[model samples]
Target chain A: MHVDINSYFATLLQQENPALRGRPVGILKDVGRTCVIAASKEAKKLGVGTGTSAYEAKRLAPEIVFLPAEFARYLDATKRLKKIFSNLVPDYEIFSLDEAFLNLTDCTRLYPDAQEFGRHVQQLIKDDLGEFVTSNVGISWNRFLAKMAGEIAPKGSVAEITAENIDHYFATTEFKDVCGIGRRLEKRLAHLGVTRLYDLHFVTDEQLETEFGPYWSKELRKMSEGKEPSLFAHHAKNEQPKSVSRSITGFSLAKDEAEIRAVMRNLIDEVMYKAREMQLSGRWAAVSLSGEGQHWWSHQRVDMPIRHAQELFDILYHQLYSQWDRTFNVIRWRVVLSDLGSWETTPEPWLPDWQRQEKLEQAAQELNKRFGLFTVRSGVLLQRPLIRPEVTGYLGDRQYVLGP
Target chain B: MYQTIHESIEVAGVFTPGKFSPTKFRWGKKTFAVEAITLLSRERDGLVPIHHYSVVASGTVFRLSFHPDNLAWFLEEVWQEGA
Candidate 1:
């Protein structure tokens, strides 16, 4: 089963304000910014959708209301929605803030009727969330088919896809209707005269493998048959991160070597702080520099675990500076710490001053946690003010206050 | 349109035992009995926790916010008919 909230961000704003209900609304990260992140159904009817600039949206609907994106509220609503699902279904995967997939094969015995169960869940979401918030529930044998059904389902309704009706569903559905088939993939498939979901059945596996790799070819074949691989059945938690990176843009571009080094140092500190917070140490650090049409990167693997920002910076600073071209006018840089392992698994420090340095670092972290971030900072960081973190979503950068 | 009004106001409401939802509130010298709670959400301003309430009263809708740190109440916004 797949459940998706319709125009989730916009709907939440409307649910909170009665004046916004039934009105064209657009949610923005900043009202002063032109980009529209999400648009209400009314705005969509006026040809204003996500990624539409505020100017374009206003040109389409002159009376459209613009509201700043409130991710905290959206996260709270998602938690409530997850609680509602937990009471009915045991296993589910949250695909995004507005969509979730449930494995109802084991729980269907409780309700007996899958369609009725989907409808009940939809009603519960609407009643518990708000009258303005509605969800489309899809019932199918697999996650891909279920998600497709949800996309094609009418607003505030349910659509069920079974072996009996899947053929009919595919006959009218386009390739874009299926998940994972974005514009790039659609254009690639269109070049091979495959535009509809039914055309996937006619394409040979060898032809698919030629365009996509063997792994994706097999995955597409399974999706064509409304079946997902067994690996996707369970929802895994607490998976280790493959890499930790921190990069910043939208600031004054670096014009000199000092500015470039400062940016790199700041990014390294953020990534290292995150690593220490997670109690993980990395063996490899990579730095990427990008400017007006040029990009350069350098990577080095250390024999010892790199746990401190200064140590990681010392390694990358030499590699990055040696390759730096004075003409590029660097605008952005990224620091990535990879090949991570738990701190317990890494070797301990053996230097004469290592213990004193470790205690000093711990004290700084404690002071930052109690007072605020960067309350105590290295002298190098005093050259530039720390960049304000921007909100993305539940998984995005978060702003925390120190005291109650 | 949502407007920002940060003035502090007086609120008279019932605080039941073990229940945090306010049954009614008086603002602008007009008393409104909360017919239904449309939404209840919590957010923060710096270090202060703010509780927001969307409620329906006498066919009109009101948005209220309470700051527990200093026991402050604010009538954030009101949506009257045809406005």
Candidate 2:
């Protein structure tokens, strides 16, 4: 069963504010951010939705109420919902902040009917989270079909996809309804005359590969047959990642060098903090920057695995930024530390400078942990707004998803 | 428009076994009687959980927070009548 909260962040806000109930609401990551991160049911009906610009949303529905997101509340709600899942199911996987999958093999006897199980979970959510908080449950034999079923289900309702009903659904559903098929993939599929989910069933695997490459072709074929190419337990708590990355899209295009550097430092600080918390370091580092139709990428294999933020920043300055033409505006930037290994495997550096740097960072980490993140930061960051550690609405951060 | 103001304030509430019902609060020099509690949510700051009460008072919506660590109440935000 795939349980997906409908209009999650927006619904949470509506649940909190009684006045917001039945009203069109657009949630922003922060005030002044033009992007609408999520839209209420009422707003969605008026064509406002996730990724809708604030300008476009207002034009769609002038009466739309825009509110800044409160991630803390969302996280709290997730915790409460997970507790309920733990009690009801023998096993469950948290798919995202607004979705989870429950393996009902053990509990089948308890809930013989799919709708009954869905209603029971919905009631529990309302009782624990709030009355306005509702979920759609998709019941199927496998994960992919279950997620598709959940997406097709009406708000606050349950839908099951079985051998008898899947064909009907495939014929009626658009190609985009499939999880991995985005606009680009949909366009490519259309070029091959595969316009619907039903059309995918007729296409040969060899044809799919020619258009989508090997990985996607295999996945698409599996999706077409209502099979998950990956294991059902893909949503299970992931092991310590091979790479730790932090990326951000600026609210506006950034042309200034200082602003770009400040943002880069902030992201590096976040990446290092998580690595330190997990007691891991990386030998490979990569930086990607893109904006205004220009993209640049640079990566290096360090002599030693590095975990300190300052050292990582120095490497980036000397190797990456110093080489950049600085011709294009930067709207998005990403920093990745790959080739990760546990601290137990890392050999101790013999240099006195390295030792002193480690000691200084450790002291700063202690202070920050006690007070809050960025309580102690570099002078360069002092002039910029402190980019505090914030959980994504998608809840993709493994460290936070796995929890303490 | 809602304004963020993390100023410590005095709150009057009834403490029951599992719930805390905030009725009124004193912000600056004025006392606003909470006509209704629109919503209540929880947030964690470090090890402490702060209870936030969205109360409608003074013809506006005011978000009041109770910090258990300090046993203090604060006026977190206020949505005014007009932007």
Winning candidate number (lDDT): 2
Candidate-wise lDDT, in order: 0.76, 0.84
How many Å off is the CA of A203 in candidate 1? 1.6
The number of the candidate with the highest TM-score is 2
Clashes of each: 0, 0
- Report the C-alpha lDDT of model 2 over B1-83, residue by residue, as the tens digit: 57889999999989899999888889999999988776677776454678888888876788888888779888988885346
Can you tell me the DockQ of model 2?
0.49
TM-score for chain B of all predictions? 0.75, 0.91
- Give the residue spans of candidate 1 off by over 4 A: A229-235, A246-277, A284-303, A306-335, A350-404, B7-10, B14-19, B23-37, B44-50, B54-83
lDDT of 1 by residue, B20-76 (tens): 776787766777788877877776424455788877787766778888778988888
Candidate 1: tens digits of C-alpha lDDT, residues A60-155: 999998888877678767767877877888887666678878788897679789889888888888887888889998888888889889998888
The TM-scores of all predictions, comma-separated, are 0.80, 0.91
Query: Residue A32's C-alpha lDDT in candidate 2?
Result: 82
